[model samples]
Target chain A: MLVTVVGNYPKIPNLPRPARLRNAFARLDRGQITPEELAKVEDEVTIEVLKEQADAGVELLTDGQVRWFDEQTYIAGKLGGVEINGLIRFFDTNTYYREPIINGPVAWREPILIRDYAFARDNASRPVKPVLTGPYTLARLCRNDHYSSFEDVAFGLAEALNAEAKALAAEDPPLIQFNEPAITRHPEDARLAESIWRRLLSGLSGETAVSFYFGPPGDAVAAALNAGFTTVGVDTTIPGVLDAIAAGPKPPKLAAGIMDSRTTRLEDVDVLAGHVEAAAALAGSDNLYVNPNIGLEFLPREQAQAKLVRLVEGVNKARGGAK
Target chain B: MSKGLLTTSVGSFGKPPYLAKARSDHAAGRISAEDLDKLTRQATQEIIDLQVELGLDILVHGEMERGDMVAYFAEHFPGMSIGGLVRSYGNRYYHKPVIHNELRWDGPYTVDMWKYAQSLTDRPVKGMLTGPYTMVDWAFEEYYPSRRDAVLAMARVVREETLALQDAGARYIQIDEPAASVRFDDIDLAAEAMGIVTEGVTAKTITHICYGDFAPVYDQLIRIPVDQFDLEMANSGYDLLDVMREKGFDKEVGLGVLDVHTHKVETVEEVVAGIKRALEFMPPERIYVDPDCGLKTRTWEESADKIRVMVEAVRRVKAEYAIE
Candidate 1:
């Protein structure tokens, strides 16, 4: 079993406190500070995000997606024919995202994510798994003003993302995980979600992982695994999801979100390890991968790093040995 | 109902750019404590003037000093310390509060702020408190025996604040509870918890729930012991008002007639139509009008424009009905 983040590390460690990073971004936009300085700061701090994961003994790692503006907006804005409509609530959290609307046919403008992935791969001691927002989530989040139907828009997005995935794979990373946080919100979209993900991951060079969070995956878990992906991450903390995965046609690897990243409350190492053990037992396989239930971006970058340490500790405990 | 379709904000006007920086500077220790407080007071006064110029019937302090609703209160209250940042939704995040001991009202959390803002405006200012259930739901429960215990303890603490505002000569108090509708499984528990806080409060009590679907807990929410249900309507095209019309709300209804989540300003005519549609469903005498949620997420200009349009629309509706 391997441990890794679903996506996102805190962009800037609190320079002195919470929200300073946001203030700095506001300054950058207003031309008080140049973009180069911000990138330099992000690059310098990103090492800490990666080192925290590696130091915690997490097997697979992520670049922490420090440079992007927000989760989907940065990558989606990299594509052609996608425009930001307006800000919308991200999930049940206090966060908001600029809704990316499909204004025309979705197409990749260039290799948007390769450099971001390569940044992590170069800095990290551990193998970095790059995270992407799944095509279903991207399409579902976008306003389909130009598409013929939901299916048409979704397929367009899928192809665009598949191209991006192949480009990232060219960097020879271990796994390219696409996060579909929205799928669980609308159970009616499960079948379509599976198909869109299938379209996106088809013909990818490296390993692939698909996961859902902020809510239970419901029946979508099994449907997603049928797409010949290597891993499926289930947020066991979201209630009823553990049982849902227990009843699954298990994937080759399961990233069980056994600890929460949404809150700063620390988890007891033994208790969290028990959750991993339970998920493994229920799945009837030790293919269980342990990690935070959601992206660590919800935490302060330094605090998120601390959680990663605890996360790997739980994973090690479940393995019945120190890593 | 007695207020006769009054117009007001849902509290928390958008922070001006300077004010946001002042806060950031203050936190980084680049500015003195007194300087930050002075800036906050000045911002609050400006917000008051803006609401007055907009012709709002009721007023809010704009919560200029608040970083996040729960965190602001948690800092002042006992047994609660603000935790690290957690994503609430898209680009928005709040520092979650971690509660380890029994909650107690250390003193007046918002009374001084309420007194200052009210002193500046002739209009009745709503004393805003993050409702006990929300504080409990949004916090990490480090010491509570159960979720129920934590919520109930928070209720007692809130009741203390509400009564302090009442004693401070405030007539209206709003306990904003936007998180209530998120946890559907805890609706009954949330309702019961709310009852404990509003149990004996003398001020006119209101609760605001926004951003979540109201269908799941409407029946239980209707029975909550409060004077008004200030709901998010315009964002849903007032479909929530339609549901309330069908089920019939016996309590006063504060109709959120403008969307506050966006920066785009609504025209006066658009606001007029929203109020007109809401009036057709519920009795006009029992209606109060406001934005769909706090304006904190919007730009200051957008918040002012939306509120101005809303107040104008309320005036047009009242003139149509020939109410004094």
Candidate 2:
């Protein structure tokens, strides 16, 4: 059984350079630091987080998103004709995202996450799956001033992200994870979400996984997962997800997120194994992969690391990977 | 000026094109330090005169020097350093403050800016500071043992500046705590921290809280020792007024009659209708008129027009009531 992270590990707090790298970015803006120095600092942070995930026995490793400001904004900032606009509270977290404003036709004029993924893959012992904020989530989150409709903006974003995804796939990464957290927010926009999801994962290499968290999606998540993807990344930590998963069609691969990501409170190992077992029963053991319900950036570093160890162990125990 | 409805902004104004150019040029090192300061001072003076002409009872320095509300403090203040940009909501972003050491007063932060603006206008200028709870809430905390510890430490640091601003002859000291609304379970901790920050201060203390649901913490919020509550009423369409009526908010309420988030300016009629709904719960004398939040997101024209419409609406209300 494969146990991987959804995306984003907790930040290494109290750095002497800048407690958070966002402040480091500010210093760079003031010309206190050179672009080379900033890139070096970012890579150092990436190494620490990537090692932490690998140490915790995370089968499919992530870059830990150490350089990421939040889910959508960091990648959105790099795209052409997109403006990083106002400060906004990022959903329910204490963290905030610089909201993206689409000013013109969105396309990948330059490579965004290729370096981040390449850097992570080199440092990691396990195969790293580069995580991208999905087109649907990005379009949903940003103010689409340029695009005619939500559909137009979403597809526009899809075309841009499709470029980045294709670039990462070319690097021979085992998989690509698209975090469509917006799917849970506007579940009513299911058809719009599915169309965008299809476009995002149209021709990517290896296993392609689209995940939802914060809440359950309507029918679009299930339809899209079954249509063309290796995994259905469901946050079973939420109340309605089990019912949603049981009621709907199953994907070829099921990434059941049985661990809580928001709080530091540790889930009982037996209870976590039980959750894994139930999901496996539905999807069958071969199809099941275990993970946290969402990103663990909200939790403190130690707690997040401990939770990772537990999630991997619990999934292994349930799948009978250990003696 | 005190007789009729008091009019002011929630503090920031949109930076004009020239000022924006100067800021970028300074950062890019294309301009000298003296050149940047001269341009900023000019912008500040222009806004001060503009506020007076707009007939606002209270005047602000227009915050031409500030990049973001939280970042401005984090940069100037000691014990904090400006971090990279984090997303706020929509397309907006601000640098989250990083507090690695114990917070110190660091001489005077906003005092010089406050004094500069006060000298420009005869009207009482607000010595604005992002409150201790918000400082603690928004920043990445590493030194403190608990969030409560971090906040109280920040409160003491803020209190030093508050007293300094009072010494500078500022009457209205607006300590904004927009982050307080986010913490529902620990609302009391935030309130207690605010109390600690404002403890033994003589300046008229006003706290502005917004963006989150106030229904859950309505019971704990009213008891905080502040002379006024500058709330985001227009965004919620005066829904908080009903809560104030139910739970009894005795402090003077800054009725945010204008929405600053969008470019669509509120008509004078829309402003009056909102205040009319608010008047049903709050007395006009106890009301202060302003926008829902800072106008940094909006264009200069939009910000100016919204304030003018708000002031006009308040004028109509005062005339109808036959107040002096």
Candidate 3:
């Protein structure tokens, strides 16, 4: 079984000293340094987190999302029609994200995350996956003043993000994962979510995945599978979610979210192996990807790194037990 | 000027340079606890003097004695351990605490600070404590069987702290529940915990909820068993005021006049416009002018400048209304 992480990792490491990211931003705010200088700090942290993940035995890596401020506005703000607003709580987490106000037609002029992807790929030893906030989730999270309807907003974002996805695909990464945590919360929008994902992945040559988290998968699992994503990432920590994913139309690959990323507590290898085995039973071992239920941004740097170590061990234990 | 439309801060003020250095040195073990405490008290005195100088109606101790709102209470509570860092926002992080066992209130935590702050001034110092819901929401839960159980347990702990503050002659106590407005589905749980927290508390209870889309929880939030609902108005462009006007605010409001998250000190006209917008919904007596949230995020100079502008705006509005 392959062990990977869902999107973000903690940018700051566990240390007695303050994070360089914080200090750099503070310095930038004081006009002591240029934006280029601050970007250099972010790049350093990104490489650090990438190395940490690679060392912990994670095969597939994300940039740890060190460059992006938050899930919504990081991409949404880069879009033509959107303007970043004041802080709002990002879902149920204690952390906050800048809200995006959709003022004009939501259009992506250029590649938003392509540079970060290229940088991570260049810096890391292991293969890196480009992740984006799903168009539907972005539309749902932001205020849509311009769109006449939800469909108008979601489709507009999808067309824009689709162009960006194609741009990232040109770099020929291992996979591109669109994190649609908002879909799990509002499963009634499953159809719209599926349609948007299809639009986002349209004409893209590389492998793609859609992950649902922050809530139970509900009916969104089947919706994503039907949307023709190469992989469907499900949060199996929610009761009966594993069974629900198994019950749904299995995709080419299954990203089994067995680990809880929100808490600092680590899971036992045996328990994790059991989860992995169950996941492998549904999607053959070759097609299964084991990961946390969501992003590791909620966790401390030490715990997040430790969880990945345990994850690798669990995957190994599962393979060993099968042998 | 009338005491109506009184000026007050939500909770924390930005820590001054000396206090900030002292906290860092204390954390690094370079300074003794006594040294840190001395500086903290000195900083608190400075904050009180600043607020007094600014001609504010109510004042805060500036929270120099504590770190993050949640971690400070977690340090005092039994069965809790302050854990590693998690980002609160852009480049801002706090050590999220872990509830490892059944929680218990060892003794009063905020009473001493509240007493000290109150003693420094004749003005009624708002006794501040992180609300039980916010503490539970912010921290990593490892002990409680359910969130509801943890929330209620924390509510009891906070209630004890509240009563202690009340007993210590605190007339105004602000229980900060910033996390309450985050989840609309769990607003009942938040409200229920607040009920437990304020049970038999005689002081004028206030709960400050900020930074989220609170429109869904506004009705339930208004009924959160507090005397006043302190909210952030200017940060979100005073859009929340429309929601409050439609919902009909029955209780007093700690109206946030300036955005604390940004360094751009709001102009007197900008603040007056916000307060006037609020005045359209609620009377001046029901409105208490303040910043959007805690000024802890801003630099000390930024916080002071923002407060000066806030006070000036309130002064102009009070003068215009002749309410006092």
B51-126 in candidate 2: lDDT tens per residue? 8988988877878888867778788777788764444432234556677777888778788778888889899888
Give lDDT tens digits, candidate 1, residues B153-193. Answer: 89889988888999999899999888787767777877887
lDDT of 3 by residue, A181-202 (tens): 8887788888877787777777
lDDT of each: 0.81, 0.80, 0.87
lDDT of 3: 0.87
Clashing residue pairs found in predicted model 3: B1-B324, B2-B324
Stretches of candidate 2 off by over 4 Å are A1-3, A8-88, A94-323, B1-4, B85-94
Q: What's candidate 3's DockQ score? A: 0.63
Which portions of model 3 show Cα errors greater than 4 Å?
A: A16-48, A72-86, A99-126, A142-153, A246-248, A320-323, B1-3, B237-242, B245-249, B263-285, B299-322
Q: Where's the lowest-lDDT run of ten residues in candidate 2 chain B?
A: B84-93
TM-scores, one per candidate: 0.90, 0.63, 0.88
The candidate 2 chain A region of ten consecutive residues with least summed lDDT is: A12-21
DockQ preference between candidates 2 and 3, better one: 3
Highest DockQ against the true fold, candidate: 3
True contacts kept of each: 0.41, 0.13, 0.76
Better candidate by lDDT, 2 or 3: 3
Candidate 3 chain A worst ten-residue window by lDDT: A10-19
